[model samples]
Target: MGAITIQELTKSYGETNVLKGIDLAIDDGEFLILVGPSGCGKSTLMNCIAGLEDITSGELFIGDDNVTSVNPKDRDIAMVFQSYALYPTMTVERNIRFGLEMRKYPKDEIESTVKDVAKLLQIEHLLDRKPSQLSGGQRQRVAMGRALARSPRVFLFDEPLSNLDAKLRVEMRTEIKKLHKRLGTTIVYVTHDQVEAMTLADRIAVMKDGIVQQFGTPYEIYNDPANRFVADFMGSPAMNFVECIVFEGNLIVESGNQRHEVVIPNTQAVIDSGLETVILGLRPEMITEPKPHAESGYITQMQLGVQVTEPTGPDTLAFGEWNGQEIQARLSPEVGAQAEIDGEVQIQVDTGKAVLFHPQTGARI
Candidate 1:
């Protein structure tokens, strides 16, 4: 029962407010991830949750207890920081057993716990090595083992894998996910890496400027972002935004001397907004090389003049100008190669999957 509830939480440094009235409820045994760019107050929020920083105002509940004023050690939570923070002179076994030893656990119990955690993290063979003798990934695993030795009510990880290389980061991510499944403890993880948040989180809280932009599952955040900011933030290549005008019930996209009308069915919100111009958001994958099945009513096909093509093994990315704005499309590597040599390609845009945003407010229409 490690459920956490935060209500109207605020944190400030003198006149500067780092967290502004944050409210969130994380269920018991759930993996909740707080993700945002640097300086978005995610780390501050994590600190507040861990009792390291005092909240300016608001109530915080861990499980059934109000732990707003509780000391970090008394909060029954273990934290794994970005830095391994292991003792340079101490062996891995001692580093892991240090927490249990401080609590006065029996020597046999500490040794058994260290062995079990080491096996779980696959670092059992490295137990006799010091921090200086281990690789970055190995050190990170040792840090995790140190935290895992304690059966705490909650686990806090603050960019724990940021120090590792890309390949090692991915491997460690899988290990973390497996650990979460094996031990169904509540976790509040903070990371600036979107891939980590997307892959590991049960739910992600996207933040910006000390405010939560949206809170939902990875699919919801990626497929149905609340606004342009969220839509632009989640994707790899980032979503493309094009400004266009609304006429009748269709959006008019003007490219050079050619004009194309994209009719958006069931667009009551856009019609009621009474705005002539709006922004259209589309993912690169949604625009692709034309196929026989691309002639649907909701699909719009256009010939694009190829400017550049980049082959990235799985798929090729084609870039060109649309309405004087740089637009990108994900195409089959074979088709993209042929299009690059031919100087033009036919691509289909799935307007049914397109999103509209209010240009002034950046909110979804």
Candidate 2:
């Protein structure tokens, strides 16, 4: 079993703490992505898991064996770095074989292993080429091949696609997912890109300032965020948190001197929070182009003055104001066909799917 368990893991440097008591688990063959901004301790946690950094305190287990104190090479893990850390002068075949050769495997065995790994990574044609001669994607594949040849207990990827061009990064993301499916390898990938975390992770651990904000499946992290930070961090267009106040179990949303009271879903959390002022969180897609039969949702229309409309291929993003705070909504190009700066536009709202957060505490209610 390649399952991993982390218990109260904490790492510090000098007087500066990096990881603040992290607890996590990864089932065998599960793809767990560690995502957060730079200096959020994601890379530090990864180093701890790979036995490259000494933990300040806590336990880490790999398949029932505690490996927190194990040496890096003996921890049975391989890491693919963002820089595609291949030997510059060494041929791809030699780079892939270097580790096995260092372990004193026989020449014939090394040759066989290299051939199989090259075939697996589809780098057979480039095996004789130096790292400088290969493209970014090829170098990354070769780096992956080197790790794959070892057949380690776990694979740690430290933003392995960050260096590639946009097109290559997308291609590599899909390729990496395919590799995971084919090999069924337990992997812990680190990335700052939310898109990568959303698209690639079986489970995501979102961190900030050495603390794990939330940990769950992509859908849960996106839809059922624990707090405002997580909700704002996960989405593409980002969620709009409009200022609102509660009055008699209904939300009072004011726009352009006009007021609208939308019914909120009654739940225990709302009753428990007991806060009158709230921030209504809604996604751009929820505020869409009005349809003839937009009667399905808690639809409310307001004469919002449009500032600018941006067409983003699939959907157009229109900028406006809610309660005098800048807000954005998604609209169809045809529906926004006549939208202009400072023009009044009727925008629909989906209050049913809206989330409420305590304005003071920023916690979801």
- Highest-TM-score candidate: 1
The regions of model 2 sitting more than 4 angstroms off are 103-125, 132-138
Q: Spell out the clash pairs found in candidate 2.
A: none
Q: Tens digits of per-residue lDDT for model 2 on 2-90?
A: 89999999999999999999999899999999987789898899889988789999999999999988989988898987666789989
Task: Provide TM-scores for the models.
Answer: 0.94, 0.92
Clashes of each: 0, 0
TM-score of 1: 0.94
lDDT of 1 at 244: 81
lDDT of 2 at 354: 82
> What's the CA error at residue 205 for candidate 1, in Å?
0.4
lDDT of each: 0.88, 0.85
Q: Compose the digit string of candidate 1's lDDT tens values, residues 210-320.
A: 899998998899989999999988888778787888887678899988788876655787789889999889999988987786656778889989999999999998888
Task: Give candidate 2's whole-model lDDT.
Answer: 0.85
